[model samples]
Target: MNNKSLKRWTFLDTINAALLIVVVLFMLDFQNNATVSWILLAVFAFWIVTVILRNIFITRVMKDPNHPMHPQPGEKNNAKD
Candidate 1:
């Protein structure tokens, strides 16, 4: 993939990691609280949705000829032509 695509992926990964950390911390801190458990569940659900959406986006972009990450004729794989 191109640098731009790599950077985008890195950013998305960082956000996901941050969310996971938050969820873990919250679980540790409020393991006995019912309301906090529900809130954490919502956050976890949102994280899962984001991961699924990111995968879908990557698949679509890789398949699109016009996308910068897609390889073109006479160009190296993952190189923009």
Candidate 2:
């Protein structure tokens, strides 16, 4: 795709990845208490949903063969910008 759309999607992927990492870290931390675990679990579930949606969006975008533009061979595949 074009650089504009590519950059927007890349930013979204980075955001989603960050959220996923944060949730995982919170879940794994030994200092987390019971209530904290529950709250983090709730937010983790929501973030998981968003992560799945983000994955679907990226998958759909990749499957779209009629992409108006594509990156050059030596450029980054996921982050064109």
Candidate 3:
């Protein structure tokens, strides 16, 4: 993958790490369990959205010329076409 795409993937990884930390800290803090549950739910939802969007973006990037993930012409992907 190009440097730009690699950077984006790294950024997404950072976000995922931050979310995991937040959830871990929240679980460790025992007070306000209800609020913590809601916050964790939101965090999980945001993570899911980011992953889905990232996949869509990567798929688009793979279609661009010169992208490392782009399939070569006349080469078949694993998926049946």
Candidate 4:
């Protein structure tokens, strides 16, 4: 039930990281402009919260027995070929 693999970088992780950089850059660029600076900061905070919530969701799914990662009581994996 370990989710070590989920901790690895995914496409979402890459995009999030990229967006984070963009947001930070925008925030810096708008330092003198309070409106734009606040907007960029809010976007960055939203991104951070979303990443945290996504990880929480993935963890929940991984722990669910009915999830694809775990086979049902009488179901056999068809991977033997």
Instruction: Report the C-alpha displacement of residue 15, candidate 4, in angstroms.
Output: 3.5
| Superior candidate under TM-score, 1 versus 2 | 1
Off by over 4 Å in 1: 1-3, 6-32, 68-81
Put the candidates in TM-score order, highest first. 4, 1, 3, 2
Candidate 1 per-residue lDDT, tens place, 47-77, comes to: 7787668667767776797977665565544
Predicted structure with the largest TM-score when compared to the true one: 4
TM-score of 2: 0.43
lDDT of each: 0.63, 0.61, 0.62, 0.63
Model 4 vs. true fold: TM: 0.55
Tell me the TM-score of model 3. 0.46
- Error (Å) of candidate 2 at residue 2 is 6.2
Instruction: Give the runs in model 3 whose Cα sits over 4 Å from its true position.
Output: 1-3, 6-8, 11-32, 64-81
Write down the worst ten-residue block by lDDT for model 1.
1-10
lDDT-wise, the better of 1 and 3 is: 1
